[model samples]
Target: MHYVDLDKIELKDIPKISDPDGRGNLSVVERDFLPFTIKRVYYLYDVPSSSTRGGHAHKELQQFLIALSGSFDVVLDNGKSRRTITLNKPDKGLLIPNGVWRELEDFSSGAVCLSLVSEEYNEDDYIREYEEFMLFKSS
Candidate 1:
């Protein structure tokens, strides 16, 4: 259960280009620029500004989270301690290792968060309850 900080992350910038269509202009993230050997890629959109997400902890997957738009606070807890990180830059991401409990809080309006995972979705890999997380960690 460890919090991989910015100093430890090997960041690879996701490419973006302008596209002005009949509607409006937009930027897209290129596939190659997303260098991770991803097994699962998911995005969290329309997250309520007053609510928080992600209360569970993973057992074997490593995830890199990026705030693609707007900003949010990532609260990380490694069995012993916790820290809150504000992610606002697209080029930056938080690399979270297995066993840590994470919570995404203080989401700004219209925030889009991208999560790149090392493994595909598996129900057994997740520890969804805080009490269970503490017990499992202790054992």
Candidate 2:
């Protein structure tokens, strides 16, 4: 395992195009907004307010999380440091690099989380335990 700096985490504002008729806004995410090509896209919705999600770290996958409807808090940890970020706007996202541990919590009612990933789903690439994540980070 190698040491990954906590500074690599970042919040980016995605561009939104508004309709002229005052109907709604459109947000776009392209290759320019991310560090790598997006290979998968998914969303989490209808989560209960008391529930939490994402208690794991990826070995090589990079992800960008966006709040499409309501709001939620994302807690990121790199073994040595930790940071919490709130996402509330559809036009904004949080970038989580590889090897970082993430937890989603404090989801407001009707909150929707959209994720853009650099790779497809692979169970072997995920580190699901905190103790194992710490060991992986230190090695």
Candidate 3:
């Protein structure tokens, strides 16, 4: 764990372009709005309602998670405290900095979660165990 303040993790509103003819709203993410450079992009969809995603903290990677379709909840834990954030809007997202633990759950049907990460897929950068994460925070 890198020991970041849990309060720093919160939702951010992305700029939306609304069409007058009801085509749909468009939200864009540029490099200036984020604290890190995006190195990977992925998404989760067609997940069973009972399943959850993410159960670890990162050593250095940062991520932005958006509910692009339906809705889901992200539970964040930072060794000493925990919080839950519901992402239901397409134009808003949760920015999770490094060191904070996250778990995504309560996904609605047809839900889509788009993730923009600061780093590539690296297993060594992840802290998967809660006990180990806590220990890392103390050190």
- Per-candidate total of colliding backbone pairs: 0, 1, 0
Best by TM-score: 3
TM-score of 3: 0.95
- TM-score (all chains, Cα) for each model: 0.77, 0.93, 0.95
| Segments of candidate 3 deviating more than 4 angstroms | none
Deviation of model 2 at 1, angstroms: 3.9
Best first by TM-score, ranked:
3, 2, 1
Candidates ranked by lDDT? 3, 2, 1
User: Poorest 10 consecutive residues of model 3 by lDDT?
Assistant: 1-10
**Per-residue CA lDDT of candidate 2, range 54-81, in tens?**
9999999999999999999998898988
Q: Sum up the clashes in candidate 3.
A: 0
Clashing pairs in 1: none
Q: Which ranges of candidate 1 are over 4 A from the true structure?
A: 1-36
What C-alpha RMSD separates each model from the true structure? Answer: 4.0, 1.3, 1.2
What is the C-alpha lDDT profile of model 3 across 26-87, one tens digit per residue? 89999898899999999999988899999998988999999999999999998888999999
